[model samples]
Target: MLLTVKIGKKTEKLKLNRKEKILKILKKLGLNRENVVCKLNGKIVTEEEYVGTKDKLEIIIIVSGD
Candidate 1:
């Protein structure tokens, strides 16, 4: 399955397995899984959220102020 990622102002396309999670995709993309957060369809998501082609995913990377 392919998931679309909206990080900041850039949108990137990712191809992953249907069972893959946002964290896996993030890691594949060289994103720090500990620092990045994910949201799917405008809702906050956990690491267990299933990634499917039917889902239009939104991934957000959280930055620490300190």
Candidate 2:
């Protein structure tokens, strides 16, 4: 299974043998789950969400300023 992930101006195709949690994917990409919001197919999803092949995932980084 291949998942399409978009992060900012970069995109990547991740191969997975089976359905996995979004948190795992974030970790694989060296992103902290706490700092990113995972959106699956235009809907907001949590780290526990399971994603499979052909799913479009957007990882939006949350920005904070003083």
Candidate 3:
């Protein structure tokens, strides 16, 4: 399946296993799981939701600025 991912300031299309979790995508991007939030469509999702095949996902890294 194909998923649209939003990372940093860009949106890109990625082909993922239908049941792949957000962590898999994050791992691909070299992002630490604790440092990012994963959203599907518009709602915040738990790891389980990402584990479900229904995740049409987008990810945004929450950064702290000084």
TM-score of 1: 0.77
* C-alpha root-mean-square deviation, candidate 1: 1.8
Can you write out model 1's per-residue Cα lDDT over 1-66, one digit (the tens) per residue?
566778867898888665677777777878876776778887888856777776766766786798
Measured against the true structure, the TM-scores of the candidates, in listed sequence, are 0.77, 0.90, 0.74
- Regions of model 3 farther than 4 Å from truth: 51-55
lDDT of model 1 at position 48: 68
- What stretches of model 2 exceed 4 Å from their correct place? none
What are the clashing pairs of model 3? Answer: none
Best by lDDT: 2
lDDT of 2 by residue, 5-57 (tens): 99977999999999989999999999998899999989998989999886888
Candidates 1 and 3, the one with greater lDDT: 1
For candidate 3, what is the TM-score?
A: 0.74
Query: How displaced is residue 24 in candidate 2, in Å?
Result: 0.5
- Candidate 1 residue spans exceeding 4 A from truth: none
Per-candidate Cα RMSD to the true structure, in Å, reads 1.8, 1.1, 2.3
